[model samples]
Target chain A: MDQTILDTLHDVIVVGSGCTGAMAAQTLLESGMKVLMLDGGMMDSKYKSLIPDTSYTDFRQKADDQYKILIGENLEGLNWGEVSTGAQLTPPRKFITDQVEIFLPLESNNFHPMESLALGGLGGAWGLGSCIYSPPELEKAGLNANKMHEAYRVVSDRIGISASNDDASPYTSGGFNYFLPELEIDSNAKSLYDKYKKKRNDLNRDGFFMGKPALALLTEDKGERKKCSYNDMDFYSDKDKSAYRPWITIEEMKTKYKNSFIYLGEKLVKEFSEENNFTTVTCIDMMDNSVKTYSCIKLVLASGVLGTARIVMRSVKSENVKFPILTNPYCYIPCIQPGMLGKSADQRRSDFAQLSLFHDPDKTNADVAMASIYSYHSLMLFRIIREAPLNFKDGRKMMRWLLPAMTIMGIHLPQQASEGKYLKMMKDENSPTGDKLFAEYSLNEEEKLSRKIREKKFLHAMRKLNCFAIKKIDPGFGSSIHYAGTLPFNDNEAEFTLNPSGRLNKFKNIFVADGSGFKYLPAKGLTFSLMANAHNVAKTVIEDARK
Target chain B: MNFAEENKYNSEAQILSNYLVGTQVDKKSLELYSGISKTTNHSMNESDLKIWNFLMKHPGFISSIDGALAFTNPKSSVRKKIFFMFAILECRPELSAKFMSSNFTGFYWVKFIWYGVHAVFTTIFGLFLLQWIKRF
Candidate 1:
C-alpha cells in the first residue's frame, strides 16, 4: 500500500456531489486548480438517457432500482446499515422523538426535514423554487452579503432561472427571476390569481401572486434539456423540461478545465494526512473495495452538513472539537373545503403553485431562510399520505381514507435550532463499533413560537384567499430532512473555524465551504448561500494557495 | 342491402356495446378470453338470455325461485362470487349417482338418518350452515 502506487495527486478533493460540492468544484476549477470530486450518489439520474420521453416510467423500471433510497419503492426492504453515508445511521422504526437517550441535554422535538442522495443531490427532487437568502438573514449569519450575492448571480447565470417581473400581487412581488423567460401562466392559474388578487390587495402586506416561482430550469433545447413546454409537472419528475441538476454544471466545468477530474460512485474517505505542506486524502473506492489516495496543496470539506459531520466525527475526536449544528423546524398547512372533492381544478394545482408567508426569527442571530410554503403534487402527496404509518397492505382502506388531503410546507425560524441536540464521542473500553453518533434534541421555545406564528399566518391567509377548512399540525425533527452542524463556527477566531486565509482556521491550506460550516438560519433554502460561500472560499483558496 | 354496402356501414360504427346496459366500449381495448372477437356483439346462450331477462325485469321473483339455473356464468381467472354456482354445478351431479346405486339405495334411508342428525346438530350448533342451505 505504498502511496506512490496511487493516482496522481490533484489540487483538491470534494465530498458529496449535491449543491455545495458541485458549486465548489466548478469555482475551484475556474480558479485554475485541478479538482477531484467524490459523491455517494449514482453516476447519473435514471432518466438522463431519454431526452424526448417525458414520462417517469424509467424510474419505475427494473433498471432504475427505484427503491434504492427514500424515492425508491423498495425502501422498506433496504437495511438501515446501508442507509448512512452520514454520522447517525439509525434503523427505520416508528417516528419516536424520545426513544434513544444520549449524553446531550434533552429538549423539545421540532425540525424541518428534506433529503435526497441522488447524483444531483436534493436539486434532482427540489421543486426548483429557487430563491436567495434575504439580506438581513445573510447578515445575521455572519456572511458577506455582497460577496454571497455575487456568487448567486454566477450560479443563476450558469443555471438559467425563469420568473416574471410583475409586482402587482401579494404572492409574486419583489422576487428575483432566473435566466429564462417566465412560464406561460395556465388558465386555471389566471382565474385563481384574479379571484384572490382583490383580497390579497386589500390585506396590504405587499404580497402578490405570480405565474411560477423563479426556477433554475433550461430555456433552450440543449444537452438532454428542452425549453419549458408548459408541462405543469415539476415535483415528481419532468421528462421534457430540464430542471437544474448540479451534474450539468459539473459537466460544463470538465469541458472548461480538462485537467480537473471528478469521480462518481465512491464513498467513505479512509485516511487524511499532511506532510511537506501537502494534505493527502485516501478514500475507499466503495464499488470495488480498493483504497486510493489523492493529494493537493489545499483540501475543501464541502460535503454538506450530515456528510461533513460524519466525516469529521469519524476522523477527529476530542472533547474540545464540539460544534453546534442547526436544524430547520418545518410544518405542513392544508387548506381544505367542505365542497372540495379532491379534484385538480384550481390554478395553483398546475401553475408555479408557489405560496409565500412572512417569518420572524425565534432567536437572535439565528440564521433563517425565507420560508416559502407551497403545495405538494402527487409524488409528495403520496409520501405524506403514507406517513400515517398505517399498514401499506390495507390498500382498500387507504384508498377510502387517504383522499381529500393536501399539504403545504412551512419552514420555522431559528433555522438553526432543534429539539434534537448532538454529542461528542467518548472513550470506552467495551465499545464494539467506533465512536457512535450522540444526539438529544427537542424544539426550543423560540422555534415553537415561530411555528405558532406561521400557523396563524397560514390561517389568516387562507381566510383572506377564501381557502377554507385550514388545519395545522406540528412536524418533528428528521422530517425537514435538512441535517447539519457536526463542524460549525461559533465566532470569528476559532482555530478549527477558519482553515487558512479565513477558511477553517487550524487546517492550513484547507477550506470548509459546505452547509456544515453554518451555525443555522431562521428560514430559507440554503442553495444561494451555499454557492456564494463556496465562491468566496474558493477565491481565498486560489489566492493563498499560490502564495 | 348488399354485402359491400353492409360492410361499409359496419366499419363506420364498429364500437362494441354492452348487451344489457349499452355502455359503449372501444372494441380493441377490452381484454377478452381467447377466440372472443373484439368487434363481435356481446352474446349469451338462449337459455341464459331467458334467465337474465327474467331476473332483470322481475327482481322480486329471484327470491322465490327454489332451484333455478344460473345465467351468463362468465368464467374469470379472478376468484369472485360467481364461483359458488360453479362449485355447486361441479358437485351436484354426484347426488343422483349415489341414489341409483344398489348399495346406495340404503343410503337413501341414510339421508333421512343424516337429516335427523343435522337437525339435532343445528339445534345445538345454532344453524351455522343456514345461509348455505338457503342458497342451495
Candidate 2:
C-alpha cells in the first residue's frame, strides 16, 4: 500500500522469512543496508485468539473436544491426536500452501517429505532441536571449520541455545557458548543419564554417548521473549514465545529497522534473472493475482531447499538438471521403563526431547546417528497404538497400559547424495505456482545396512539402561524434516554448485542462504547450521556490495 | 415409542455414529443433526450425538461422561473432535471386548498368539527389570 517502499530499488532482496532469510536480513540490516523480504505465506492470528494463555492440560482438552469439527474425520489416515507434534498434517501457521508436487521412482518406496510455505517456513513448526556439527563432520560436509565456528557463535548469541558441557561433549564437540540454562530432565530421561554416567566406559566402547541436547528454547527472559513455561505445548502452540521461532527475528527487524527492512507477505516468487548489473525477480502476488517484477542490486535465495531449487530450475529452463538431495533417514523406537509408569501427567516441563544419544561406530567414516529421547506423555497414545499390527481396539488397550512406561527415541541416521536419490523439476502448466517439483529419494543398500547397525546399537543402549525397546517404526524418509543439498556449495564451481560463500557460480550477484547450498547433511538437526551459514553469507554479501 | 419415531431416531443415531467414525455421510444427515441441536439446545452435533448414544448403550462410561461432554460445542470443530475422542475413551471397555472375541482364521490366530506371547514376555521382563533396578 505504501508507494515509497516499492518505488525504491532495494540494495538487497531476501526471499523467504525462515531461519536463514531472517538471519541474513538481520546481518545486512545491522550493516545499514536496505533489505526487503518476500514471503508466500501470511501469519494466522487465530492461534493466538483461540488458545491464548491456556495451561497445557486445558489446551489439550480444548483441542481434543473441538478436533472433530475443526479437522473433521482423519480422512487421510492422519491420527489427529498426534497433530501437535507429528508431521502428517500442516500446522495452522503453515496451512497456507498446497502439498508440493512430488514424484517418487517406483523402486523408491516410503519417502514422504514434509515441506512448508509458511511465513517462517518449516522453522515455524520446528522441534527446536539445535546442535552444531563437529569439526570433522563439517569438513566431511565440505565446509571450512574455522569460518563455521565463528558463524555458529554469532548465530547462537542471536538465538539462545540451552545446553551443558556433559559426557556428550566428545561427540557434540562442545566449544560454543550458550545463552540460557539447560532444561531439567524428566525422571525417565534422568534414569538414562545416570545409567550413561555409571556405564560410561562400556557405552563409549560401544560408540554410544548420551547427554542433554541443546535446544533453541530460552530458559531465561531475553529481549521480548519470555522463559519457557515448561507447559509441554512446544509442539502445538507458541503462546510463551520462549521457544525460538525465526519470525521473532523478522518481527524484531521490522521494528528496529522499519525504514530499512520491509516484509512483503503472500508473494510467491517464480524466478529471477540478472540484467544490467541488477537482478530482477518475477513473482505472483497471490492476494491480487498480479504478476510483479522487482529488481535489486543483490538477490539472496533463502526460500528453503525445495523452494530455491524450484525457482532456479524454472529460471535456468532445464528439466534434465539433477541436483543431489541429502535427508536424514528417520525412525521412532518406543522403549518402556516400568519405573516411570503411572507418574503424574500434570507436571509441567519442556516436552521436546531433552536428551540425545550419539553413536559413531566407525569413527573413521563420517557416519553418525543420533537418537533424541521424548517422554511418552508428550505423544498421543492412540498414534502409538495404531502402529501395532493388532486390531485398533486391542492396540488402544495395550497403549493405555504401555504409554505411561514408554519413552520414544527418534533415531536419525546420516544420508549422502546417491544416484537413486535426487530432485527433478518438471514444468507444469496447470500448477498455480508455474512449476511442479518432483523429488525422488531412496535409501541405497549400504545406507539400509548402516541403519540396521545403528538401530541395533540404539536398542542395546536402551537395554543397558534397563528399558526394553518394544517396537520400532520408521515414519519413512523426509519425516526428519531436515532437507538439504539441491544446490550444493563446492570449492570448484559446477553447473548446480555455489561458491563457499553461497554465491551461485553463473550469477555473481545471486546468493543462496538456505539448506539448498548444503553438499552433505549430517544426522544432527540442520536449523542451527542453516542460521550460521546464512549469517556467514551475509558478511560476504556486505563485503561484495562495498567493493 | 411409535415405529416411525423409533426409525427416525435410529437413522439419526446411525448417521452420527458413522460420521464420528470417519465414514462419508450425506448432507441431509448433517442438516438433520444441526436441526436437532438447535431444537434441543444441547450443543449436540453429529459427534456429540454419537457419543451420547454410546454412553446410553454403555452405562460404564457414566463416571467420566460428564467430563467428556463438558466442552461440547456445536459450532466448534475442535470441540466436536475432542468429544468424539472422549466417547472413544469411554467406550474402550466394549471395544476391547469386541476385539478380543472377534473370530480369526489360521494365520490370524497365529499372529494373535505371537503378539500375546510377546506382550506377556515384555511385561514380565519390564516389571522384573524395574524391581531389580529399584534395589540398586
Candidate 3:
C-alpha cells in the first residue's frame, strides 16, 4: 500500500472482500463516500487456467490435460483421514481455504469451520442458494424487516437471482423482485419434484413444502455474464460467469466507482483502535509481511463473524473473552430416488440445489428447518463409492447403477446460542495471525434429540416422495459455514455488542456489517440476508455520519 | 519412489484398474495415480501385502477377497487400493459413459440380475480358492 494513501484519512474502511463487505463498499461508494477495502484476496494461481471453459461432461469426455484440475499436484483433496465437509470441493476451489488456518487460526475440539481469505472469501464457493429471510425471521435477528426487505430488492436486482414463484416460495423466497427463470435440473430432481406434486396435499399437511429454491445463477445473459449452460461444474469453476460471486460485484465497483472505491488486495486486517475521532486500522500486508496502518472516519467490520469477533476482542485488549457462536448443524443423507431407478443420468443439467424442501410445522417462520436437495454425478463416483459397503469393483458397478437415482438431501437445522457453544480469542505467538480463536461447540442431549426427531420426520417426508434414505452422513459440527451470533447487535453499551444501527456499542466510529450482528441464525441460507444487512448498515452509517 | 517401489506401484495399480475397469491402464496413468497416493500413506500392511501377493498370483481372487471383507471391514488396505485405482480410472473418458450408464433398457433387470448372480458365485468360488491356494 502507498504511504501517502495510508497517511490520508479515508472516508470509510471496509475490512473484507466477502459477500457482506462487497455490498457495504458498493453502497458506500454509490453514495459518493470514498471507501477503502483491505482483503487477503488470495486466488488460485495454478488450476484456474488448466481447467477448460467447457461443460463438466465435455471436460470428462475430452480430458484436455486434466491431471491438475481434478487431482492437484499434491493430491489436495484425496486424503486417507476422515472426510472433511468440503471434501467434494474440486481442486480448482482450493484457494477458498488455501491459507485460512495460517491467516485466521482457530482451535476447536469439535467444531471445524470453513473460513476463506480468498479474493471473494467464502462466497466464491457458495452453492448459489439464496434464501430470503422472512419478516419474522429478520425480527428475531434484531434487524429491521421493512428496511431489510427493500435492501433485498436492491441486492437482488444487482445480482440477478433465478427462481420461480412456486409452492416453496412461501418458505424460501421472501417476496423479492427481479428474478430470472429457474435453471434446468436433472432427472433425479425432476422425478422427486413430480412425486412431491402428486403427494402435495399430504406432504403440505405434514409440514413439507418442496419446490424450486432461489439461486444466484443467471438464467439468461446479463451484463458481461452468460446464462448457465447446464455444465454441472458449479462445484469446480465458473467459466461463463453464470453464477454470481462476490468478486463480480467488487470488480464492478472498482470500474464503476474508480475514484471512490479503492481495494487493496493481499492485506489482512488486524485489530483497530479509535483515536481522535478516527479509527486507525492496522493490517499485515501479505506481500512483504509488513505491518501497515490506515486511518478512516468510519470502519465497517464485515470480516465474517469469527473474524470480526477476533478483532473486537483483541481491540478491547482482552486476551480471552467468550462470544456466542451459532451455526446451522448440517447432515447430508444420500437418498435413493426410486422413480429414477435404472434411468440414465441427464446429459445436460446443473449440480446446484435443484429443489429446496422446508420443514415448517406451522408453515410460518418459527422453528423451521431447510433441506437443499442436489442431484448426484459430476463430482465423480469415487467419492460416493468409497463409502459403499461392497468391494471396490462391486462398489464401482453399484455406484454406476445408483448414481442416476441418487439425490443428496443436505439438511440444516436452526441453531441458537448455547452455553457450551462459544468462540474465544487467545494469544498465540506461534501463529502468524498473532491470535487464535478457540471454539467449544457441542450439542446437548435435548438439542440432539430434537434434531433427530426432526430429521426422522424429514426422512418420512422423503419416503412420501419415493426417496429412501439409506443412512445419514454427519459432515461434522459448524460445517454449514453459516456462523453467526457473535457480537450481536443490542441496546446496551457492552464491549462485545452492537447497536441496532450496526454501530459498536463500546466504540463511537466503528460498526459491523456482517453476521456478527445477527441475534438469531435462521435455518434459511444467510448469504442474501448478510448482503442485505451490510447494505442497510452502510446506509445507516451514511445517515449517522450526516448527524 | 525408487525403481523397485515405482515398479511395484505400477504393477499393482495396473492389476487393480484391470479388475475395476476390465482394461489395463497406461504407465503414465499408473505413475500419476501412485504419485498422488505417495502422500496419502496408504501403503499395504502385512495382511494387506499377503492379500496383495495372492491377488498378484491369482488376479481372479480380488472379487472374493474384497467381497468377503466388504461386510466386515471396507477400509482394508487392499480395498482402499482398489478404490484408489478406480478413482484414477474414472478420470479417463475411455469407459466413463459406460460407467455412468443406468442400464435404462428393456432388459435392464436382466443385466442387473445377472450381476447379482455373478457377485454371489464369484464370492463363493474365491472364498474356497484363496484358502485352498494358501494351504498348497
RMSD in order of candidates: 17.6, 10.6, 2.1
Off by over 4 Å in 3: B120-136
Pairing residues by index, what is the TM-score of model 3? 0.96
Q: Mind giving the per-residue lDDT tens digits that candidate 3 earns over A1-547?
A: 4877889899999999999999999999888899999998888888777777777777887873555676666656554456666776788888988778788888888999899888888998888888888778888889998888889889888888898888888776765556788778777888899989999999999889999989999998998999988877778788788999999989899899988888888888888999977999998888777899999999999999988988888788865678998999999999998677788888688878999999999877777899999988888877777676666676666667778888999999988887889988877897766779999999888999999999999999999888999779987987788999998879888778889889999788999999998888888889999998999999988987878
The order by descending TM-score is: 3, 2, 1
Residue-wise C-alpha lDDT for candidate 2, range A251-336, written one tens digit per residue:
88889998898899878888999877888898887777678888899999998887788788878887588878888888888788
lDDT of 1 by residue, A131-220 (tens): 566566566565666776777778777666666555321122225443466655433234334545566555444232323455566656
**What are the per-model numbers of colliding residue pairs?**
54, 11, 0
The CA lDDT at A199 in model 1 is 68
Worst 10 residues of 1 chain A by lDDT: A90-99
What value of lDDT does candidate 3 attain over all alpha carbons? 0.83
Ranking according to DockQ, highest score first: 3, 2, 1
- Which has the better DockQ: candidate 1, or candidate 3? 3
Top of the candidates by lDDT: 3
Model 3, residue A530: distance off in Å is 0.4
Residue A307 displacement in candidate 2 (angstroms): 0.6
Tens-digit per-residue lDDT, B97-132, candidate 1: 211111223343455355445434433332222233
